[model samples]
Target: MTNGIRVSVVAPVYNAGPFLHAFVNSFLIQTLPGDSIELIAVNDGSTDDSAAILDDFAREHQNVHVIHQENSGWPGKPRNVGLAAARGDYVFFADPDDEFGGPEALERLADFADEHASDVVVPKMVPRGDRLYAQWRYETTQIDADLVTCFTTLTPQKLFRREFLLDQDIRFPEEKVRLEDGQFLSLAYLKASRVSILNGYDFYVIIHHPQQDHLSAKPVDPANYIGSVAVMAENVEKYCTDPDTGDRIINEIYFRKVLANFTNSRVATHSLERRQAWQRQQKWFIDRFITTSRFEKMDEIAQVRTDLARDGDLDAIVAYARAGSVDFTFVSARSKRGNIELAGKLSGGFSDGELPKLVVIDRNDKSRIVTIPIQLAKSQVTVQIPKETLPLMEGARRYDLWLSPGRGHQNRRIEGPDRPFSLHFTDDRDVELYSTKKGNLSIAVSRGMSTQARTKRKLKRIIGR
Candidate 1:
């Protein structure tokens, strides 16, 4: 009863006329054997030439299959339909605007799944342009990865064992709903026995279309979005039996999706009525899932905002949305004895007695954080780090600096000057301070000869200094 198809790519196409050619071409050029792969393009009542383009591909290629359906408003119904029609061992849900990372993307994923007997396979997903995803989880190939740690990645753009999905009766919520991907993936993760993460190469390239807006890019109603999240929370409670694991999953969702909505600048633009409705919905979720102990473990800013929203303090919440954000400006750096002294200015809407803390986070290992108290005199701040404090024995280290405005206020990264600057410590350790692409201040520490010292040594050998 089984065909030879190893992978079936189910793509729900809407008004994707502009991107249809490149999208379909990405699949056609796959290095996976022609007979082992199929592309199922479900046209969801596209108004443009998308239907014609899909039909053309189907006629030209035997592996390309096209299904036409009425507009589903969202991708859920079309995705479900495409899933039902898939005839491969594994199913991959794809968006028409994005494409495979390279020619061998599907071939490698299918081979890895077969070797590991994986119920779910997640390949490295890299954004084409400036978009970012959490890269820490995909740092290495993992077999049977912990679902709790991998909960942040809930998108349906992963390889699912078609039999496992069918056995669990897992299907997308067939409605025009937000976070349907989260709901579907949450159930899959809970039911999956063996989940494998492949990090060797990029398998999926997420591209942003210049002329079109993705579904996630469209404006979201706060109430409706939170309602969808609540359904995901319900899934966690129902399927996840362990209370501790359930709390961790729910807490992560609350932090990433629920609390982030209020802390971001978008909430500032909401009308009074809209903000109130958002607060009401958020409070409902928090009361049900987010316990006090778990809430306290969140960032100070998140704790403050959630508290304000839960208490229905509209004025205070608005003030936070408008002005309580933080920022830092780096002025200079100097070598003091064997230590490094940093000077910066902190700016934010803090109350009269509030103070900001200098937070140093290790880029390699986030658990290693150093918090230093700063005395702000006329907005100027200074901090000195001893040579012993630098993780010099760890070969090379990069630490990002942030200004954490105590309690009730959000933190911000310190912005450095236009050009990178360096300072040499007396401990034979060289330090280069630079601004990251995102304009955040970071210092790289390395042992042995300093760059300046190396340049001097080279000059001495040439000129006999």
Candidate 2:
């Protein structure tokens, strides 16, 4: 019988001094049996006062121990160090910036662990704010699977049997510079049994630090993500049941991990060469997955565009549109002439040629212009953005969506319309549209365009003064 399971919560600290206190305190707030729950705080060579922070906590509480290590090149090495130090039979990994769903959730999860004798127990997530939706990786509904569901999407949401991890020789790839959380899960899931899932507990408070995207600032290289994705793809190909299943499994991993390079690029502070290198590296990595045929999927395009944009590739947008990454639709009523406009009698297109690549998004399909290029000799030109490219924005912080145009650094700045307005391009060609809310609401225009001023004013009106 599984001796009363020892629940060890693994908190990996690296320059986590800012949020270290509450993260540690969240555990202290839990209701688990005092002896049953353990906190293994790994201070992975934090240059900040993070080690001191953990040290302070460890001093206050015996469960919160710290493992000081050298400055490793990757996040996984420190986690591996922590894994060795984890004394509990079940290990719970937590990021210092995030928090548990609730104080009692861990206790409940531990109880569930005792009841099912599960190798992996997954918890759910709920959105913590306006711009962000909770990400639980696994499905919210009750799911029980040995390979697909258990071993696949639900990797991050579980409490793993430490022995199973050690027995299988499962270790976080120390070489991986990023996304190993997924890699770690994929590795362990294959050997797991009785993967139980628990709802009602959002075990982690994944913070969306808007100011910190690689686009807006420095980030670990996207190439590191490539290495991580490569590891996952190899693992998936080796362990999955069949070619189809393996493809799908690895496809999802490829989608998320590789897409990370792009997403991180989006957060970069400027269009620097370093960011471009990441994008280039990402493009190279994506080259592998693109041939998988699934790249043709709209979600695939969406993922690619996101990665590209994150990598700060404005040109990636052309690829995004060409790949049919934009899936938004328009409800346009056109004039006898080629001119196109919106439904509200506002901004209309002069010609089909005037309708540059545009994608219009709104609460409904009744949008005016979504920024998809369709040659309108004044005819309405519109298209849809794939669901992936325009993810729902609920709790993003400090988004720097600058949309100025022409080309390169010379594009003029253009904010989105003042309000959600309809279109009336030239004549009877009037329609309505909305832009996606997932990123910055700015757009740019070229000085070559004569109507740029009118376009900017109309947008200001549409976006609301």
Candidate 3:
């Protein structure tokens, strides 16, 4: 039955009493017409006032639908139930702890999907807490986004054509499994004919409650988690037709899920036995998915740690993780004759033959690398960006700065200066150096209004001339 609802929001609720009111209200006041949107709240055996709250909303609002199901431990089963009961053209999966980015979020997503006939519409997601989302991918609206590059975002907080999902038999894994979202999204991305990315407006906000521990934050058994990741990798291998695309997908998994574990501070704190067990499990996926060619393309630190893990060198891995910590501080920056100079201090334990190199990475296009001359002395490192190089980087763009430990060592991001430092060039282009929330140093270049230009505009406004 084709109802008037254009979008069905499926939220699996479990003991979300504290956040229920705000989450439900976020939907109730949506800019989308009340008749065009429906909220499917599936109470997965929540032993709190969650069920009562949902019932109250259902009684008050015609668009709110409530479903009761037994506890499923994970969100998979309840989400599947909500999916089965959705009666709208498009479906969006949301977590009860989080809420829509804005009231107009749903309306914009549905309109974009309809205009472009997008089977999957990925909206801009902003993190409310310390959680970090890949904001680079959502910098601009892409009508036809590539799945290979956009593979990092595997969350289910996206708008999907319900008919497309049904025709493809794509459903969340019902069992209590980690990376279920990865498995489901991989299939959807592979089968989706048209995928659109809406980045102009924030559509989804991921809120991190201080008192509540998110499902992903819970302690995970390394073996069990790796097993789930293996399943997700297998799905990509099975459905992905192109070998190159399959390799990229698997490599991403290996880098993020496998190698990144060794770098985590918790690994060093774990007992030797536990660390060894984690490495052994990681090696299985590394052998199957991580190819030498793709492996070489990873950052130097990732390469070293992954090799150690593959060899099952538990002692070496622990020692390397402990000794690999590097700290960088921005000391000074200046601009003269269209040239920009940055000076920073590196303080950390470095290997015997390790040398420091400045790494400039383009935030917009990560693949592009811009190299400039760097001088590394005892503890201070200086970089000189020639005027010629500025032309190649001409645009309103942000570039991330990093300090690499020579050729075969880890790269540490430079961090410092709470306040941003601005400098103007001869051509009136402005350069600003600032620290990211994570405290990494980055440079922003733009053709902004000069001080003189701003003063003139202000005077014109005051004089009414």
lDDT for every model? 0.82, 0.56, 0.82
Query: Over the stretch 1-465, how does candidate 3's per-residue lDDT look in tens digits?
Result: 259889999999999999998999999989988998999999999998999999999999999999998899888888889999999999999999998989999999999999999999989999997667778888878899866666788899999999999999999998877888988888888889988889888899998788875778877778888887787788888887877777777777767776656653766668877887788888887887677876866777667777888899887777666555555578899986578888877665454355456778878888967766466777677788765544434568888987765544567787757899998876667788898998888888888776788789999999995
Error of 2 at 136 (Å): 7.6
Residue 432 Cα positional deviation in candidate 3, in Å, after optimal superposition: 9.2
| TM-score per candidate, chains pooled | 0.86, 0.62, 0.80
Residue pairs clashing, model 1:
none
Q: Candidate 3 — which residues are off by over 4 angstroms? A: 291-302, 330-401, 406-410, 418-465
How do the residues 1-465 of candidate 2 rate in per-residue lDDT, one tens digit apiece?
A: 234437788766777787778778888888876567777777767788888878888888866677777777556777778778777878887777677778887877767777777777777755444435435444553545535454445335467888888888888767635666767887776556666666765666656454322221445666766777777777776876566666566556655555543332243343556556656766776666545454544363454454555466555544333332122133442222333332211132122222334433332223433343443333233333333323333322111122212121111122344444343333222233334364223221112223565688799999995
* Model 2 clash tally, residue pairs: 94
Model 2 sits at a Cα RMSD from the real structure of 11.8
lDDT of 3 at 348: 55
